[model samples]
Target: MTRTRGWLAAVVDIVLIVAFALIGRSSHAEAASPIGLWTTAYPFLAGWAVGWLVVRGWARPMRLWPTGVVVWVATVAIGMLLRVLTGQGDVAGDPLPLSFVIVATISLAVFLLGWRAVVRLVAARSGRRGRGRV
Candidate 1:
């Protein structure tokens, strides 16, 4: 991938976060307005930014193990921490509920890391095929 496509990866991460928020809101039957979606998205967005820093994502936006995993983990960790602090997290009977943590971790992992992994695989196969042709 070229340097220009790095921005596309960033955009994808942000869009995925927004989509996650939209789907979550829909699942809960919450109001799906721009403001509401933004509110739901901001905490995780902040975390996503931190994940970028933590993983130095611009350097390797599509690296799956450290780059993708670090981003995914940081997005959930920092996002959940911020959410709990701000009282926007999905808390039920308990303050730091296990169900909420487990669900968020798994969902965020899949959404945040899955796309990059797919891209990495495709890029690898494309490279191999191109080499074989010449």
Candidate 2:
């Protein structure tokens, strides 16, 4: 069950990251091509992978403390770094403006951490109900 949950968490993270890129692209009226989406998403996905390794997320993938927080930080930090390094910023010749960084940080935080919070809350409520029943 844990192994399955770990994989599920990883998949959910990936999906959310891609969705972040997709939404950003759409909002900016950029071409919604697969290549563009992949270009935008891969850096954050790589950061997420790094976070999983750092946290050994498979052990407790659903934990909001170390796992989710580390993943969220890493995804934003590393993702922004990569975007700047690769010249993929919102504007040409100005890789990684302050506004873009701020927006990306907040947006990715919401995307990466929001669902885990919801899941944790739901699970807690369900567990409480089960305990009361027994």
Candidate 3:
């Protein structure tokens, strides 16, 4: 159940990130390319995998937020580097503002952290109350 929940959280986070990117793109006139598409999608998938592995598999709440932050930051940096290496396009396209990056990072971090917190809190409370009865 925990594993399933963690994966669900990750999928939700991916959706949220994509939504943010679309919202940011609404203000722009040009259509984003396929190269840009992968740039946005891959990072969230990577972050999602890491979040699930660390939080659900290991049952470690302490690692959730910090690891998420690290993964998101690194993902962004690596993405920029990849775009630069390929020279396919500018790292910061018109749609992806600095503000958008910050918001996306926060969104991913919060979703990952909040899910773990809720799961642990519920389990802890249940355990405590259950112990009293048994």
Candidate 4:
């Protein structure tokens, strides 16, 4: 997929993540700060990054599953670390909730799976061309 497409997916994922976070916060009466949003968003961004990396041929798409998972885990962990450092949120034993994990997993899977199909479709629709006098 093109960078534009990757960004589009990332933005969409971010929006979805934000929506989910808002709902979760409202339901749980948790303080939803900017740091919370960022922490929530990192995994979505990571998924898109992995998708872009795969499209660019830097990594195998199948391998991207683990990469995306690792990225999501790392982003969430690091975000929580930053939150603790900044004193934005307490270092509760459970940094994130089950919903966050579920949402991130779904987001990563959708973006990674959808990206390849979209790229292939775009390429096929654009039609292949050959050089002359090869």
The model with the greatest TM-score is: 2
TM-score of every prediction relative to native = 0.90, 0.94, 0.51, 0.42
Compute the lDDT of residue 37 as modeled in candidate 1.
98
Q: Is candidate 3 or candidate 4 better by TM-score?
A: 3
Candidate 1 residue-wise lDDT, 13-124, digit = tens: 8999899989988888999999999988888899989988877888888878787888888888888888878777546645567876797788888887889888888989
Cα lDDT of model 1 overall? 0.83
List residue ranges in candidate 1 displaced over 4 A.
90-93
Query: How would the candidate models be sorted by TM-score, starting from the highest?
Result: 2, 1, 3, 4
Compose the digit string of candidate 2's lDDT tens values, residues 21-87: 9998899898889999999899989888898899999899889889999999988888888887887
Alpha carbon deviation, residue 53, candidate 1 (Å)? 1.4
By lDDT: ranked, best first = 2, 1, 3, 4
lDDT of 1 at 12: 90
lDDT of 4 by residue, 48-132 (tens): 4554454542343323355434444444555445544545433366555565556545654455445545656676666654323
lDDT scores of the candidates, listed in order: 0.83, 0.89, 0.54, 0.51
Error of 2 at 74 (Å): 0.8
Which candidate would rank higher by lDDT, 1 or 3?
Answer: 1
Name the better of 1 and 4 by lDDT: 1
Over 4 Å off in model 4, which ranges? 30-67, 91-134
Error of 2 at 115 (Å): 0.7
User: Could you tell me the TM-score of candidate 3?
Assistant: 0.51
Model 2 weakest lDDT span, ten residues long:
87-96
